[model samples]
Target: MSVPVPYHATAQRPEWSSLPARLRAEVSTRMGAPVIQARTAGAGFTRGFAALLRTADGQSAFVKAAPHAEQPHLVDWYAREAAILTRLPAGLPAPRPRWTLWEAGWYVLCLDPVDGHTPRLPWDQAELTATLTAFADVAEALAEPPVELTALGLPRLADLARDDLLWWGEVAAGREQVPPLPAPARGRLADLVTLESRLPRYAAAATGLTHGDLRVDNVLVDTAGSVWFCDWPWLCHGPAWFDLVTLLITGYATGLDVDSLFAAQPAAASAPDDALDVTLAALAGYHLTAATSAPPTASTNLPAHQRWTGEQAIRWLSHRRGWL
Candidate 1:
């Protein structure tokens, strides 16, 4: 098989000019200066508008908007992100929300822009270390969900896995098919299915705010080597180890010694062995299932990315279970 590519193909985002005139005027008025220039951001899979804006006075802010007509779900996501960011504890290593607006069928959000770069693929060890260290801090800060946040009706990890982590079941029922697997995995499909079915039980009792989508693209490392996590729409309450395990799956694909890394992480170290296995199975099933489908309209390369990560997850699990 060919080596799978690591990145997804992002759609061209909407430009500033595409926004309604009144909305642009409102953004300028709020910035206290006329808009000087706007450049759309290249990261992320959402087919909405995302850009870096500069005001006449040279102030800079990150802005994202989505028209309800084209992407109603994304509009909801931006609104959800704004709500979550506003409630995050002060001084956390995340961008602060500046403003949010809804006007003329568009949902807009402004945020403080970070001077940082997304981590390189097949991660540099030093950067990976910094990311893991920063994640520990993030976990500690969100150890207890604020009463206000719990009321947002965020989906629990257990509940999410029930629906999302069932690719093998789909295959077993002939609803989906996966590419050929190695001898070890081929024989263990039944075991994989059994393991995945236990996801909810293992995911239960996990408590904390999790960056539900933790990946290299979603993280930014500043010059000072601090990690700033972005894309908060998927924020949910779950075990602190959830995010770490998510990172580890990608890290393993990138050639990191994930076992060593997991041993060093305090949050991960506290998780029961069975819980860890269940999380891995769920993630493997999710990515593998997603990989078998056609790419979504918003991203042409997402299937390849998922396939690569799913392969890594399978390899990682094989090692842990001493599979052929």
Candidate 2:
């Protein structure tokens, strides 16, 4: 009899009824029937509207929308997701795009509905195993980028993390507030900054398609126990073990024996220990820096989530380095 803590809290969702009438009509037209019910999706931090919609004809689809006026960046994200989903290899365990529309100053996407549940926080071992297995399969399946998505111009891990990881240096120079760091991590800020500087070099050898953002909420477990990965906005080209490292950080924070888990993964096992350390440092710096900033519009809980994740990353780094 205890309330379960969510992996991350989602922001308030815009109701299906709140969409403009023209947009609703277009969605109904695409689904081939009038939507009779809409249940808001209870996962993710984006301010965009997402919901499971059922039509009068019993058809169902996952619909997501974001108005350009409110979230211009999200509109681009949705467009990117639509493009990525369409180009994903056939048989990948991800939702298929049914249709996408840009009208009435809103970008809308309809996808094949995935009947699954988000993984529990702290993770159930079996669920975690399934997700890991799926990550490996997906990574292998997407070893190279598809021809259609080549124009996405996804930045390399090195380029993306190089500047973002310097937030600690900014904090040290009094340009930004000190993010909440554990006692052990507080005294080692300089070391972290130094470690972060080497991230690009460590990340340089990475070569493979990667789900840039991998976390508990972005994954789903179907009734048959298969794992389904979602949120393709951050899809990019990076190291084969990139997603695994991200997941292991969360696992480590939740007290899982991530070292053993990493050893068990073929992709992860191939990565050098130093490379993994650099990746962790990069992630820790990025999260810690973003966590200290002002909350993003419509995502009031994002800063808190980022702060918690930053703490976890720092704690994991401290353990790895035996920092005091």
lDDT per residue as tens, model 1, 1-324:
333543322445778887889989988998889888997766666577888899999999988888888788889899999998998887788888999988878888999987677777667778888888888988888888887778788888778877777677777778888655655577788878887887676567777778889876788888888889899988887777878877877777656788878878888766777666666767777887777774443656567667776777777887788897
- What local lDDT does model 1 show for residue 85? 91
* Every model: Cα RMSD to truth: 2.4, 2.3
- The TM-score that candidate 1 achieves is 0.91
- Tell me how candidate 1 scores on lDDT: 0.78
Candidate 2, poorest ten consecutive residues by summed lDDT: 1-10
Q: Highest TM-score: give the candidate number.
A: 2
Question: TM-scores for all candidates?
Answer: 0.91, 0.93
- What candidate 1 gets wrong by more than 4 Å, as runs, is 1-11, 179-184, 294-297
Q: Give the clash count for each candidate.
A: 0, 0
lDDT of 2 by residue, 190-286 (tens): 8877777776675667666788888777898989899999998888767767677777776887788887787788777657676666677767777
